[model samples]
Target: MLSDYFPSVGGQRAPDAELGATLRDFVAQQQGPISAHLRHRHTQTNEIGRCVALWPVLAHIAQESGGAALALLDVGSSAGLNLGVDAYTLCYHCGGASVHVGGAPRTDCRCCVASCVGSAARSMGCANLPVAGALSHRLGLDPMPVDVRDTDATRWLQACVWPCDLVRQQRLALALELARQHGWQVKQTGPSCIEAIHAWLDGLPSAVQPVVLNSWVLCYFSEQERARHEQAMIDLVRQRGVVWVSAETPSLRPTDMALPATPPHDSKGATLWCQVSHHAGEVRQRALAWSHPHGAWLQWLG
Candidate 1:
């Protein structure tokens, strides 16, 4: 709407909520003749601050769509490394199928969650005993896709991981490889994703349930632009019987205002996961949680 999602912040050095100038000073302090060639590395790693925050969103999609062939649109996906996360990893059983990757970092799963999984597997309704396979299937959409294979991009990708971000980076790398293996085309520069996604849906055949769609991209949009994009998505969901889920953290908590309510772009946005009919209708679910690819936890809204 305003040239780019950033509007016009001018050229002033923006203030970060955290990290401050530590990153700048850290690189400046380390120097050798070779260090002169690596000046830009600092800014690259500066981005890893809250990198892994996207996992819950991906996990939510897996549960809602279960097996739906989704056409994902990341509102402001940078380098699009997130899309690759789904492809390169696995879920381990015994302990309720925790995730594992050859070279990625790990997220400590709740032991209680694992116990529930084991119990469900042993339930009488589960006629197919001795489940031995891992959960699979993942998709993503990004307006800006970083070249996962580019040397600089890869290094930047590696640098962007946070101090304890072994799990995120490794998972992303695995996902990227899987995307290539499966031919998941990531569109780096496309028209407004709001419109593009609708058009793409037009070409899909009917009976595509859970037609799951989401936006993990707000950083790139101007206030009004984010609304337009979100509204466009909602309108489509209303027109076609499908769910529109969203998740955003409240920019500022509300007093006298309801908590864990339907998404409104005004506040920062919650880590929301919702659904709509895939065909003609106007039905939506505001309370839901992560339950996907594998039988993950399905906690309710707050």
Candidate 2:
């Protein structure tokens, strides 16, 4: 993101001619040790596109979970932007052919376009798609959660967007604005986010169904750590019903995990979307779609 946001790096076209070289130079010139900054900084790409792919699935789970308010636990939530999904509008362009629109919640600002819910539902092929209920408890768990209110932290969040993608940049700005308006609570997940899940869920009222979301987080963990986190989710289901949503690369998935169809990729890579349900003593996992990591578009597998 730095390469895109930093004036020195992105201002001149020549320096950005080769992305690898431009980043290397930028890192070398910084006064402090790069390692320390990397250790502390987390790319909280609270991507809106991801929500396009995820919202439908969330709606499905919410309906199945008795339609009460949710206690959302976001694992590896950098600035917890994803937690603000309900607050912003979503526009989905499928196959670069069809445009489906989804509305944001009611906002008082005049400049803010009142989000409406017609086209978005039509595009997803769900007539009565349920938007998530009021969040009784929204908690983000990250080793390094960015405080979106902080200027530096906010800039870092913007910097995480890809260079030259004006649409995504605008979406990021909107998501951040919504996050600022709605206060989101982020807690440290400690050494393992999986281990910390139980405590967070236990604290919420039983009426509020628990929904745990992780987007491209486990890839950062070692194989053993990944296994531990997966096991933790399974245990959460066996003990008490919960919904686990994940967006991950295929390689990080278990061998038994199935994709709705073979994944397609762009210049970036593949991101497979999945939803796991533990309802009525039955644990079920379904592959929903293949999408761009940041949710640029999605090909629904159903």
Candidate 3:
């Protein structure tokens, strides 16, 4: 279906008139199937481009932990593609200075290049970015987990991408291939994300540190639910020594988390990267950077 409509997937341009007619005819013939699919599946982009913004934060956490192996728990992980964060290469270019992370060779890797902006870009250099460390385990929590092994599930994941986004489509394909090779694990979660985290925490090895990650997920929750989730993160940091990494909108930031003196000028549609941890018995929250929702660029704040 995608191949018939999208030129990037089809290898030939489809005339606008024919495209509309074909779609209408197809919909009329397959109304039942289309409706069933829409009713059962939610849009799950599973964008791996987010890893460009995420790698720096993960590296920061690893460095703070004395290079301890991390056990990643990704909430709302669509196909668990971002679980292969350690496998891709990230190249950051800020004011003519460039830095690279990940073990994959440039040619054979799912490589992403991001630019930096704002006054903070002046001091940004290679030394400022921490090298990512090892991952002891990877797990995802989603109400409906997409299995890469399932043809229908993977196809639905592809259909979720915008037809015009060729770059993202190619990147997603690479990430899906990597996921199939790695066999990432995704567990079904109940209504409470905090409860799901608690269950997974007990099962992790003591030597590895637990890092909970959520990107653009809290927006789906109600106001009360968002507040509850924020409070739960603070409590987890103080009690269980867990770290919470979030990439969400500025409006969704926790009440106690201090904002930067001068927020990013281009923050209108940007995602705020943040880390919540405990230091000297106090729950500390730091705003790390401002980035494009799909990580096209980043403005380093910390």
RMSD of each: 12.1, 7.2, 6.9
Best first by TM-score, ranked: 3, 2, 1
Per-residue accuracy of model 2 over 1-302 as CA lDDT, tens digit each = 34464442445343455678757787888747667768877656666567666666666566667688877888988878777666555554333333222233211111101221212232333223457666678888998777878888878778787756766676677667767777788887677886678788778887888888888888778888888888878778667787777778866654357645454345256677777767557777777656667665555553
Candidate 1: what lDDT? Answer: 0.39
Which of the two, 1 or 2, has more lDDT?
2
**What does candidate 3's lDDT look like per residue over 8-88, in tens digits?**
576456556677777788889899999999898787778777877787778878888999999899998878878888777
Question: How does residue 104 of candidate 3 score in lDDT?
Answer: 17
Top-TM-score structure, candidate number: 3
Worst 10 residues of 3 by lDDT: 102-111
lDDT of each: 0.39, 0.66, 0.75
lDDT value, candidate 2, whole model: 0.66
Which of candidates 2 and 3 is the stronger one according to TM-score? 3
- Select the stronger candidate by lDDT from 1 and 3: 3
Q: What 10-residue stretch in candidate 1 is worst by lDDT?
A: 111-120
Question: Would you list the clashing residue pairs of candidate 2?
Answer: 1-159, 101-120
For model 1, how does the per-residue alpha-carbon lDDT over 152-176 read when each residue is reduced to its tens digit?
A: 6665655555434344455445544
TM-score of each: 0.53, 0.76, 0.83
